[model samples]
Target: MSYKNILVTGGCGFIGSHFIHHLLKKYKDINLVNVDLLTYCGNPENVRDIADDSRYNFYKADIGDYNAMSSVLKKHQIDCIVNFAAESDNNKAVSSPVDFARTNALGTAVLLEAARQAGVKRFHHISTCEVFGQLPLKSKSKFSEKSPYNPRTPYNAAKASGDLIAKAYHHTFGLPVTISYCANNYGTHQFPEKVIPVFAIRAIQNDPLPVFKSSGNKREWIHVSDHCSAIDLVLEKGRAGETYNVGTGLEKTVTNIADDVLAILKKPKTLKKIVPDRPGHDSRYLLDSSKMKKLGWKPKIKWHEGLEETLNWYKNNPKWWQPLLSRSNSWK
Candidate 1:
């Protein structure tokens, strides 16, 4: 509510679209300018329901385009920029590392520069805990802000680069920046490639669920709505030049997820098909969300309730998720 007009990059994507909806519904006086490239993953249907809202506007443009970014910032009188734009798939990164770097690294730099030129009041960058590398599967260890970057894949390395650039802009240029490394997000409107959706969609069709060889890879899952709430808090109350980890501590293995999907949809356990794991696939990812807790922000979604609702969403919305299945490659 403090910022009258906010620019949300990648607003058509899963998390971004949810955040945009959260902001518009929570703050009546605010205006949102959604900037998205509408890439293979950025579906307009994610936010099409709000297309006619007087406070919402969408612009199709790449985040790396400085001229276009700067123009939109000024044209919308944007006071803050929440960057959610990036090439998010690791499978794609395997064959196209440069493409990942181009958007995740260089594009972030360009957007930060544009924000500097436009004198935005606040700049919040979205990041992943994968930048801190994999943790031992059985250990109690978790990723924190103080952890060093040890990205395993090209996609994560590029995201790590983007995080560094955001910190640099804040320290060197005095940009009011706050970055967040959130846990794995699961909910409706997510591209069908990620583990949860892949299981849900396959289970609905009684198709074989592709489970990575070990299928024991563990990751903390946070409902996308909770992640959006944390972002809202960071934008409003977080200190500049700081990074916060957002997670629910609801860690579960990929096998556990597939099982849950199978049971939820009354499918047989035999639907799980063990597949080869992808390169640079981590064994575990858990975040120490003490910082976000200190800020009085915590996730509210219960795992069973949240996951079931998410799976049911994919079950009911086949038209939206079914078409995108072909775009995904064999990935963990």
Candidate 2:
């Protein structure tokens, strides 16, 4: 079923903004309503180019605020909701666990309830691979859809709670819902705080790339565009009350990523420095995305090519990232 009026929470944020742009370009008759709180990472510049489109509208509101979300849904006559709003930073979540719970967990429940009450056609929840916790450094096993939730960080714990709540809403209330857990995403317009952007920017500036102790910590990586495509597929064909994992099946370690970035920029490998690992740091994360693949969705971008394109983006767009440097300090 094709949806006409869609409410995309956190539309001004990285992945949400990209998804909005993709939808606007792909569907001519669809109307999109973007709800974003414009937090530190949510920058208006991300979607400023599409701000004036007749079919697209923007609302400066928090999804956690039930009254605000309700008003927007009613005002827009929304039929479908793609939820991307949450406190997603691991370090920040450790420092402020309450904020994570309030946003990732409580906020999700609030939005789910609102969607149920409004009779929205479908509620798609965007989640993270961290909810399955880490795998042994030398283990070959990957986390599948049936993998038990074993969140290690405050951020993942909160996201896990949100996923469970979404499931509960579907089983208990029969509200149409689908959940997707995705691997680490890297692409253009990403905030400099994330690993890819941070390393890219630091490499370009000849700054030391900080590697956590035991740089062998591995993560599955996927381009933001691929992740968005998977989400769209889930919204269109995914069965209600089902969970799908999305990833490229490619894995790289922290040191390997940093080295690759430096190599792409023709910089010295000596710039890599080992630093203390963050609290509750996971050693590795791997996902088995066979479920999403069976749904006719697969990642298109290879890590090396995507990494170069992303590095070039950061290297060329100084104005977009320069202003955010002061705020990004806290993330470091």
Candidate 3:
């Protein structure tokens, strides 16, 4: 349960950074090695505060590169691996499906091989409920760990492949792997490409905040901190080859989310503009997190509370998300 040296892939990203912080704060004696390829969304500044700690080390490497992953594992003498590396943008995945496949599928395969060779004690993978595809509007249905995968987008398809690959390794090679499928995450340090930050920044600038006209489409949202905590609990008590779903039962349409962000910034409602929905956009994503709750992890932050706090974060820190606008604004 206690990992002496844990290698966290993609630790510079939003959710991964939060997980690293959680681990460092909870376990003082453990050392962490963060491996991030530093893609457009993966910013080192996200974890800059903890970069100087003696207990932390970082490497810039691709998870798909077997040699690089093996090197990092051996150098850090990692006993546990927590993987977050992926090309996660849905819109971008539509245009560049190959890129997503390489990272989500091939990258996972290579990482698992490296972990098996290193004989790591545990390998925990983070996943999305989108892999289960959409639910009907206003439906009570939710994605359980047992739900059949119905990925609608190239991104989710690739992620589904990665999850299957991980499971295969556990079944065939006896690799100790635990996977968690979570609802969408919102929190501080999230890339501007996401909904909350995009709305907040555009509202701050009095620019149009784009929203698809899918009034019935719903998405379950959970605070990044809550999701991170779920992963931590899994590492401690979860069984290998088992998958858990993490969510708060919180569902909201994008229109509602845009309105909330504007309200938080005291901006006018006119800032919200209806835009054409992207290709392969799922109509809904809901998750049944009772499995995770059974492990003593539950969502702590409410939707409005988390949204306001997240918008405030963007308002107070322009330097962090401003530079990202040009880097990944188009997501091409």
Question: Tell me, what's the RMSD of every candidate?
Answer: 1.3, 1.0, 1.2
Candidate 3: where are CA atoms >4 Å away?
330-332
Query: lDDT tens string, model 3, 1-332?
Result: 47899999999999999999999998999989999999989999989999899999999999999999999889888999999999998878977899999999999999999999999999998889988989888678777899999998999999999999999999999999999998999999988888777788889888998888775578889999998888989999999999999999988889888878888899899887888888877888888889888889878998888888888888899999777888875432
**Candidate 2 lDDT tens digits, 92-197:** 7877899889889999999999998889989999999999999999989999999999998999999999999999999999999999999999999988878888
Ranking the candidates on lDDT from highest down gives: 1, 2, 3
Whole-model lDDT for model 3 versus the true structure?
0.90
- Tens-digit lDDT track of model 1 for 1-332: 77999999999999999999999999999999999998889999999899999999999999999999999999998999999999998888998899889999999999999999999999999999899999999899988899999999999999999999999999999999999999999999999878888888778877899889978889899999999999999988899999999998988998898888898889999999998989989999999999999999979999999988998889889899877777767433
lDDT of each: 0.92, 0.91, 0.90
Off by over 4 Å in 2: 330-332
Q: How well does each candidate superpose onto the true structure, as a TM-score? A: 0.98, 0.98, 0.98
Candidate 3's TM-score: 0.98
Question: Alpha-carbon error at 164 in model 2, in Å?
Answer: 0.8
